[model samples]
Target: MHPTTTNEPPQTLLDLITDVLSLLLLSTITVQSFIGRWQVLRTKLTSLQSSLSSLSESPLWSQNPLLHTLLPSLLSTLQRLLALSRQCSSTSSLPGGKLLFQSDLDIASSSLSNHLHDLDLLLRSGVLHHSNAIILSHPGPGSDKEDLVFFIHDLFTRLQVGGVEFKRKALESLLQILNTDKKSASLVVKEGNIGYLTGLLDFNDQPLIREQAVSAVSILAASNDESRKIIFEEGGLGHLLRILETGSMPLKEKAAIAIEAITGDPDNGWAISAYGGVSVLIEACRCGSQATQTHAVGAIRNVAGVEDIKMALAEEGVVPVIIHLIVSGSSAAQEKAANTIAILASSGGYFRDLIIQEKGLQRLMHLIQDLSSSDTIEHVLRAISSLSVSDSTAQVLSSSTALIIHLGEFIKHGNMTLQKISASLLANLSISDRNKRAIASCMGSLVKLMESPKPVGLQEAGALALVSLLTARWNKKELVRDEKSLMKVVQMLDPKYELIDKKFPVMLVNALLSGRSSGCRKRLLDAGACQHLQKLAEMEVSGAKKALQRLSGISLKSMFSRTWRE
Candidate 1:
């Protein structure tokens, strides 16, 4: 230092002191910045912990009264704090990011568990007020899933024990649960809760609760068979029956659906009829709602499957009611009513005449003319098939050229189902000599339809009808066995009517074996009917052996008679 001379300049004490003070100031600034950040983070964590702890202890945390006042504000604050923590974590790659996320999740889970515990306690203690308080607090769009589940379980449990007050609360809670999840609504039904809920059917004082209970029971009944039986056992049928008798329009409508579910069991068809359920269901068809009327008709259809059940309903004037539903209700109602009538008419000629006498024919004609409803058209065609071919129907069909013309058009343009029905109706029309002549006038068109590329079912029906007319004694001389008609039948037997080809040969053998008409048997035998039948017999098809037996009889008889003459 002493040797260092003029080349090196010496530092002044003030300069050194200034440098030291500047270093201390920088250090202090650094320390203060870190302290401020740490304090902010620590404050956040403390606030979160306090909120978590206070979630259970504070009176505002209680769901009874204070929660209604504090829940909205608390949720908002929680959301804001979570957002701030997320933002802070994103800005820095510090260890606090993971810690903050875990803390948030843990706090949320703990809070949910605490709320559930509180609801459980309220339920166990039978304090519906507090339970409802918990529910009300959790209201609004963004409620917690786990909390909702817990609340519903508690409410249901309380409903199992509590009386009217708890029932009211539970019913309200059930509405919320049903609105939340259909599966949850189904779960309550699965747990035998339907029995307890349906017990409220006796409560006339609270129509709202009664309505809700009925709605719940109906939902349960629709899901499965067991719940449906529970509804019947718990007087649900009786309540619905009474409602159908006395309830307002809306109640009657719901009751109709409920009754359908209950009576839909095929096993209960007779029981339903015995309990006057059929009459009630038929009466419900008179209501304004098309849905109600449709359901009512469907129930009647179910019950009508049983003979005694149908008779009971018929005695109660079900046919007239269904005819009214068909004519006056909506198209859908008309379709359902027609379907039920078809089922009723399928029983026999008695219902057929009844349907026609009750102006069901007019209703069916209306449906047939309605192009808007394909279902209605289909059912109308079915009704036509179901009509009896008694003398009265034959007379009407013969007199009404419009009806025959309409049926002819259907035979041409309708679906396979409608075509089959039309074919059957034509067969019925051809049963009488007068109607046969009426149908014979359309033989050209009938032959065309029989040869069309439509379903074999319709063609088969048409062919049989034509065969009957052609084979009739009075018309046989006038009938033309042209080559084209014969070839069409042959083609029907070869490929299109494989399953029913055996019946074709049988019919031919029968017609030939009749022996009442001279030259008919020789004509059929000459037309390869014998060879075709012998070929079928070798294939071992049913009725083939009978055909062979018949052929053997003819040969043996001819041989014996020839020997006797010799």
Candidate 2:
């Protein structure tokens, strides 16, 4: 009888492999005694044994589903080969016998070759690596601190070597872990998993994979300085730039957020520009989803701190992009866009002029009108203030009647910060002779702002704005007409008030006194400026004695006019 064939099914992948290898060895030994057709069995059995032996080294091979499926086919094919070899060894090759057996031998040989091909494919596909990793590193269910360490390491291995499905599952788990535990971000970075995470950004065929990858990166970027630096050093920016350039709206949004956090360091700005990301960022601001536009503008704002990149942003037409965002984007987008405008404008007059050219002032006014958030309004106000600092820009702002009215309202109703920036911007606009009357309407609000005991910057800015407004002949009369405002201005000069800058208040007195109107002089006397001016003169404060002299002359002139009228 032929050696007894074992019909028992394999209990494990190792058992299947062992059975297949044993059958191949028997087939090869039996074929060695056969004639010409037997060589086919010998050659194919050797190839099959070599492929199976390669997998035998992994202790977890039985856990791999692929090997389990393919190994059984190898066993059946080997049995066929041994049977055909036995036929060839025992029966002489008569013409009819050769014809009958040749077909069976050919079929067995082809089956062995096909099975070998499948095994080769499995080996090359990295399924072995993925399977072994999964078997060893699969995490326990509990998410306590100790278990998370296991989970993190496990997920990282999956990310590094698993197939698309495994990577997706791993990324989902990683996102949850990262979102709830801030410390895990550093752990990921410390383990050098950022490279694998960023590598997923290139998986265009797998959008969910890329989406989760970029989301994880954003968390890591925002986690700590060390993570941010490592991400940059690990080529994360290039991947982010690619996403900004061509990724879907959601991907772009996540990439922008990551870039925003990374660029917060200021030192990372040049790399973004070097990668040609500035223009792509502008495109996002112009056309991305509302959330994407918001974060993209924030990234641009952070990157604009670098001088070269700041110039590049201006050259790439970020001004109009910002203007568009301010006009049409969501409130969050407008806030970041407005803040970006402020940063770019502050760099130099060229950028400030570019903002003006793009009709940025009008767009900002629209945003400010619709905005209710104090923080957003503060960002817009900072932009307005930066633009208004330039003489040319101030003249443009002076022409916006709505804006002038808004400034008055901000000063009257906004919080301390709004009051400060508003007064500062209004002061900037008032420097132009044509803007004084238009801005002078805010005198009462300015005086009220000046009345606050703290934040001397607001007080100084208000005083300065008022001083500029006093230069206008009509404004002098207006200030005199508002007795409360006049009294606040006069009180600011008192030595006991201890104002940081008494010069502007002294100039206010001199301007009112120098005017031809005796009404202002009479009003100053009524507001009790004479006593404060006298005290300042004794202290020898700059311009205080000259202001006192002017006020005394006005007093004499008024007295003579009273005598003449009598």
Candidate 3:
């Protein structure tokens, strides 16, 4: 039976349990008229006695409100049974005859069985042992932790054994606790209450219950990977997808967020795709709320990392919706959309052409100028860099003076990651004479990066970009004039630096030698370039012997000897 709230003073659970036990002792009367019924009633009472005795032994029993609110009703029923038993024993003709009271005896017996069932469920649920452990860990007089544990377990009990109204109230309280206490939330996962929580997602008629259940589950999903794994193992994804399909806006948004977190793990990606969530997620991106669009796109972003899932996402027509988001969504949504496009575009030119067909590059260029957050810029830049790898797309990107300038700024002033990526992009963009001229202004900044002592990625990218530009005679003239930059390029060729790719600097020197200018050759000799080139030649490094051959016409030994004589 559900506990009733009343104006009357409440009895403590201990007092009520005691009254119930004593009432059971008093209920041992044998009726003269109904011999068989009396025996049956006695057998049920014995079972109730044993169950109640075991329940009272639980350390949390006295503190539990469900049992407290319930015991008084049991006492009332026992009182009626006792009075009826006394009546059957006392007078030959009673206030009510045996046949007249048959229904009443049956009612009493059925109510006792129901109460016994509720009690046995509470015991067998193992909540008592778990809650008791919580209490012992925080033993104190009315400590808040102790009280919270009691409330959490009671809510779990109600969720397990209580009626609809009881479960509803329990879910509300559970969400409230979950919102405020992170530790308690961890406790719920630890105690394996996720099944109970996810169970409520199927409450079709109860939208509020479903909302609250997903809300709690989303919290748990975001908590850690273990909680997410358990949620998927328990089949929460199907219910979440159903909510995305048919639930209210708020529920749909939450389901998307949970999906986002769940799919963050690469292993969980195929399960969502197998469940056919890809279409729902794309639909959410098209029409869901800003937050929903953000996280749904985020889920897509996570899953799109897998090779097969990447194709799956692209085939689902995610490209157009993602492009739409990049064009119109909020900053976070745009960032995620950009990242998803980047992942897809990194795979091949097929995705790049799709993005371009959707005018993704144009929209991404707009974001590069409009968005302000560094993280958002980083994601947008990453997408652009990946897309710009295609020669056709590189043509489109190089046409944007603003993008080339931004790449320069990012390489010169942005973080190391941005610098590396931007430099690589510049290397791609500088393949054309027109793009090389447009990118010539970034030459000094690239040289500055190459001068940095560590982080071979940035230095290597910088060298590649500068080397790509050095093919243009005017660009080579500018590099030769910057003697310090020229010396840095030569020093990078030393084998002791163990640079990732020595070919970029070697290529730069070869380009500088292309003109066969004596001044440039003399500068290379003064900067100790001859020794480094000779060593590289001995090692048979690509282009090293070629660079030395270019210098052969200058008579390297006599040139240095002539400079020393001067």
Model 1 spans with C-alpha error above 4 angstroms:
1-133, 136-152, 160-169, 176-186, 287-289, 348-353, 371-374, 431-462, 466-492, 495-498, 505-566
Per-residue C-alpha lDDT of model 1 across residues 1-566, encoded as one tens digit per residue: 02212222212321232243233233333332234543444444444344434444433323343233223333433443344344443435535665775566456445434433443444343333333443333334566655555565556655554445656777777776665665565455554356667777656888887877766666667767877887787767877777766776777777778878888888766777666676677667765377778777877877777988888877878888898887777776777787888888788878887898898876676556654665777777777666745676666655666666666666666666666677677766645555555545444445555655556565567656556655555444333354454444444434235544456535534533443544544445445555565556556555544554464455645644664696
Question: What is candidate 1's TM-score against the reference?
Answer: 0.58
Model 1 score (lDDT): 0.59
Residue-level lDDT tens digits of model 2 in 167-255: 77778888887776677777777754677677877878887888888888988987899989988988898899899888877788888
Q: Rank the candidates by lDDT, best first.
A: 3, 2, 1
Order of all candidates by TM-score, from best down to worst?
3, 2, 1
Q: For model 3, how does the per-residue alpha-carbon lDDT over 343-427 read when each residue is reduced to its tens digit?
A: 8888787898898898888888887887777777888888888887777777878777788778877876788778888888877
Report the number of the highest-TM-score candidate.
3
Q: Kindly report which residue stretches of model 2 are placed more than 4 angstroms away from their true locations once superposed.
A: 1-144, 161-165, 180-187, 190-192, 204-208, 365-368, 374-393, 430-441, 451-456, 471-491, 516-528, 553-566
| Pick by lDDT: 1 or 2, better one | 2
> Any idea what lDDT model 2 has?
0.73
Q: Which stretches of model 3 miss by more than 4 angstroms?
A: 1-50, 56-63, 68-121, 124-151, 307-312, 388-391, 430-434, 451-459, 498-501, 552-566
| TM-score of each prediction | 0.58, 0.67, 0.75
